[model samples]
Every structure is written in C-alpha cells, then in structure tokens.
Target chain A: MANPVWMVLRGVCRGLHLTGYFCAFGTALFGALFGQPPGLRRMGWGGFGVALLAGAAWFWLQTADFASASSPSAVLAALPLVAGYTRFGWLTLARMGVLLLAMLCAQKRCWKLAAVLSGIGVLGQAWLGHGAAMGGGKGWLLFGCSLAHIGAAAAWLGTLPALALGLRLSQNPRALAENYSRLGLVCVGAILATAFLQYLFLIGRVSAFFTTAYGAAALAKLLMFSVLLALAAHNRNRLTPALPASRAALGRAVAWEIGLGMAVLLAAGVLMQFAPPAMAMASMGS
Target chain B: MRRSLFAGAAMVMLAIAPAAFAHAYLTTSKPSAGTTVRLDTSSIRLSFTEAVQPEFCAVTVVDGMGTHAETGKPEAVPGHDDELTVPVHFQMAGKYIVTWHALSVDTHKTHGTYSFIVGN
Candidate 1:
C-alpha cells in the first residue's frame, strides 16, 4: 500500500524538477541576450559568488540519490542537500532575479551586461569541466579548477562570435586586421590551456580519445575545433590583408569558422546531458 | 536607430519563456506544520506531489533549542511512496521542528519548514 505522503511527495518532486530546469537554464540562456547574467545581478561580485554556490548546490542535489531505504550514508548526505539547497540555490537565485531587475533599471552599459553574463558562464564549467583522470579525493574540486576550465573556454569559444561580428560590422581592412590579430593571440593561450585540462578530465587514457561516448564527443568537438582553426589561419594569412573590396571573400571565410565553432558548442550542450563515467563511478550506480 | 529597444524586447521574451513551465509542489506534511502535539512520533513524514531524490533531499528533526534529535538517519521508503519518511528518536524535545529541502532532477532546489511541540 502506498502512503498519501509518498503520492504528494512524488508530485512535488516532479514540480521542483521541471521548474528548476525551466528557470535556471532557460532563464540563463535568455538572460545572455537580454543583458542580465545567467544567475547573478550585474555590476557586482556578490551576485556572482552566490550564483556559483547555487550552481554547486544544485549540482550536488541532482547527482545524489538514496539507494536502500535504510542506508546511513543516504540519510546523512540528505542533510547537506537540504541545508545547501535552501540556503544556497533558491535563495541565491531569488536574489539574482531581484538584483538583475535592479541592474536593468539602473545601468546603461554593454560591458556591464557582458560582465554579468560572463559570471553566469561560470556554471558551464561547474556543470562540465575537467579533472576526471584517476582522482582520489579531488574529484569535486570545481571552485578553482572549473573556473579555469570555463575561463579558457569562454575566451576561446566566445571569441569566435565576437570576432565574426567584428568582421561583419565593417568593410575596413584595418579594423578587421586589428581585431583578427587580437582574437588570434587570445585564442592561442586559451585553446592550448583549456584543451589540456579537457584532456585531463574526460580523456584520461589516451585510448579514451576513441573509446567512450564522451571520448567520441570530444573527438567530434576537436575535429570541429580544428576546422575553426584552419579557417582562422586562412583568414589571417590570406584575407585579413586584402583590401576592403576583397574583404567580402575574407568575411565569408571567417563567418564559416564562426559557424563551425557554434556547431561545436551545440554538440557540447548534448555531451553535457550524458552522465560522466566518473560521476557514475562515484555514485556506484547507486 | 532603436537597437537597445530591440535587445530589451528580446530579453523580455526569453525571460518569460521558462516562467510558464511551473513545477509540482508540497501538498502537505504531518504531524502537520504549526500544530501542537503531545505524542512521540515514530517517524517524520512529508507528502510531495512528485518523487524526490531520497539521497539529496531530506528532513531533519531539530529540538527546542535547535539541536538535531535523530539518533540514526532519515530514510525514504521503498516501493514508491509519495511521502518521504525520516526516523526521529526525539530525544528530549521541547519544541521540535522538521525542516525539509530537496533538489529535483530538473535541477531546482526547494525548502520548507514546520514546527510542532512535543508536550502540549
């Protein structure tokens, strides 16, 4: 016989799930363009810190699952979930929404909005960063490690869109050339460091580069990344120097690279939906 | 000429999209919130509209002076119970309160609190 309490609990659980997904990711994505950061108020660090904590708590809860009804670990872990969720996720998000609105009312700068959005971008790493290779207790060190992972990613992946838009904004070679040089140098340090960490985290064994589903996803993204790099090389070497008239052809080439980078990002989105093997091992399949 | 306005309109639409999708909620709790009780209970029970992660979500029994009373652990019932159950030994309780927190699969975190007196 099922208890009425269980029935109600199940319903409420489902509601929390749906609402959390809808508000957190959906709202964050919308905020990206609308001028608010994903989970924090613009123009301050306080909103950003809480947003990070909220993301972590959300991650912790989403990952844990009680196995046996009478397990001690299950019961103990549950306390932190409750405490953190109430004090971290919901409360922070609520504050973020309020502050976000206030910032919208009070501010009038594009860079200000970009800074906020960049803060939201941090969770992308917390959700999907590196450090999966044969870890003992450092399995969940996201605060520093994950931050670096996303920083490099945003610098690399985020630049394509910015650079492409720059190219399109003008037919001037000087502007295109200057922006291209800056973007190129930034991508240099970013791509190398981030790719190294990504390899460390997800592709521990060299064989994993071809073995697991995650490995295959990584391979695909790498292939796409290579394509972006090739096109960038072409733009810098063959196109950035061309006159304003010939810039048309160069613009097309750079746009194609940006397009490829975006495709890689979409695949990344899909890859995140899969549970990491490390995660599975930690849970021990419950 | 009005590029900022266009950006604002786009944001407004995006922000509203997720708000339309609401989640389930807690229907009730027992021995009920804000009720005076004179009996020692075997377990704390919570009723939700959906199944929650028994591991990540839990209820704790706090004493009158804000000390935990559960000797062992709070566990969820097997075979799909709508109400999650927690075992509380209730050691020396003046005013015990049960606070619950949960994060669902969709990644939303929620919490609620209720208090009941051990001796009426």
Candidate 2:
C-alpha cells in the first residue's frame, strides 16, 4: 500500500488536474458553440496553466509511488526510467504536450481548434486510468466507455461556469440558457450511458459497492451526481424558462451545480486510488 | 425523461458483454506459493495478469533465518513483459519466503509475499 498522505495528495492532484482540464475544454467549447463570452478567455488560460502544473505534480507523485522512492533525489533518478519506459509516463508527457498546444491555439483566438485539442486532452486521460490495464477487445470497450464518460462530464459540468457567465452578459439570456439546457440534456444522456458501462466493467458485483473503498467512493460520487441531476432539472424546468426575470435564482442554482460537480470530480479522484472490486478480487486470488 | 435515460443505461450495461479484469495481479509463480520444492530450484519466477515494469519492480527471497537467499535484481524474462525472475541460492533447506513489489505498466503498484518449503 502507498503512504496515506501521498495517496491523498495524488487524489487531490488528480482532482485539480481534472478541474483544470474541464474548465479549459468547457470554456473553449462554450465559446465555439455560443460565441465568446467576456472573461472566458482568461478563465480558459488560467485553466490550462493549472492543468499543466497539476499534471506535472501528478506525474512526479506517480513516479515516486511507482519507484517507492522517498526522497526527491531518488525520485528524480527514477524519472528517466519511468518517463521513458512506462505507459503512464508516456501518456502524461503526451497530455502535457496537448495542453501546451491547446493553450497556443487559445492564445491565437482559435476557439474551435482549442476546444478540439482540449477535448482530445481529456480523452487521453482514459489511458492513464484503469481502462488501460485491460487488454484486447474488452480493453477497447472500457476505453471507449471512459472517453465518453469523461467527455460528457467535461461538456456538462465544465460548461456550468461558462453558462453562468454567459447568462449574465447575453442580451437574450433565455436563448442562451435554453441552448445550454439542450446541450446539457445530450451530455446527461452520454454520461449516464457511459457511467453504467464503466461501473459494470470496474465494479462487476453489487456487493463490492458495500465492501470496497473504491465502491464507497463511487457511491458518494453517484449521490452527488443525483443531486446535480436534480439541480439541472430545476434549472431546465423552472429556472431556465423563467430566465431574465429569475436570472438571479438561476445563477445561484448554476453556482450550486458547479460546486456539487466539483465535489463529484473530487470523489472520482479519490476513487481512482483504490482498486475496483473486480480488480481487488483478482488481487486476492493472486 | 431522466428516469427513462437511467433505466435505458442500466439495460445497456446489463446487455453488454462482460469485461475482463484490469490491473496487474499475480497469476502464477514457479515454486508455487505454499508448496514444497526440491533443492534443485534455481530461481523464483512470477507471472502477472498484466505487463509490469521490471526496472522498478523488486523481488526478494529470504530463508527462515531472515537471510537473503536471492542474488541480483529482479529481471524481466526476455520476450515476456509480464514475468519476472530472480536467481536464488538455497544453502540449508527450511522455509523460504518470496516477496515481490511490482509496478504495472499502467503505474499501479502491487506487492505480495508467499512462502514455500525447500525440503529433500
């Protein structure tokens, strides 16, 4: 087992990295779809910077864990071997390059290109996850599921802040809200479909939900997700329709959604630290 | 509508083919765990369910007297990314413990220990 502190730190880093990537991707995507909103450029840039820094930290921490190195020097010494040889290391390096290119595109005011690059960066994360551990066709299935899961999540949760910002500035706030609501619905469908597939692939048995640490964290994430769904329903059914007149209330609701979404992402980060129940059972048998 | 989507997703999950296990786990070992081996055993070999990085992996074989019975670092078997071998020397046969810490290619770390008797 890894040191508890390191494990927690790694989880936190993963959360922050995901938060940053989603922010960049979502902001760029929103701009691509609905025109650039005020302050969105800065937000996207800040997100890219955060993703780069947090991703670097995560790679360093993972290297340390993999090599069982306690000291900075030891970790540095192992860096070449890890970064050069392992899949995780190579993927991390590739993601860094992707983020840098995305940032460059954003700097050039190419919102669509930036969005595509950032979305690819998000998809690239699937390989760094448990999905990459499997081989053959099942591996591809898990990979595909994970890509859809994270991409849809990035689209929905990542877009919240942009929607809030856009709602404030758009002359036709109702139209803007309605557009986002439609996108949210599609995103929700993708999220649900992929999430179920991933759960089946990773958890397998329902009993593991009660027995394993990963399962518990997954349950927590699900609860948060449910709350987010309810909030989205409230926004679409009540707040969005009454928008412009009830913009303040809608804004507060969106803010809550953003907070809960971040919490869900954090839970996901922690969940990745533990072996999924199916993997745990396999480990035990070994 | 949301409820319907959830139900539909559940149906799809159930309908899809079962997935294979992910993450690396010890699948088999030479001088298998908890078994008696003759003194002729030359090395300890371990195979995992997935590819693991040999550069960072560690394996040790120690006798009942707490003395290291394995020599040299664990090495990857040529042409096999999932198996590792460490040469061992047994002087006096008793019970020997084999412990391994493996770092899978995906960067997940796992470790385990097992004992085997080395009797005539």
Docking class of 1: incorrect
Best by lDDT: 2
What is candidate 2's CA lDDT for residue B95?
A: 94
Model 2, span B1-120: residue lDDT tens: 999997897777666647456667787888888889888778888888777878888888999779998988999899787889999888888999888888777667878888889997
DockQ of each: 0.03, 0.42
Q: What is the lDDT of candidate 2?
A: 0.83
User: Which candidate ranks first by TM-score, i.e. highest?
Assistant: 2
Error of 2 at A219 (Å): 1.5
Q: Candidate 1 at residue B51, lDDT?
A: 42
DockQ, candidate 2, vs. native dimer: 0.42
For model 1 the local lDDT of residue A141 reads 40
**Which residue ranges in model 1 land beyond 4 Å of their true spot?**
A1-107, A110-113, A120-143, A277-286, B1-120
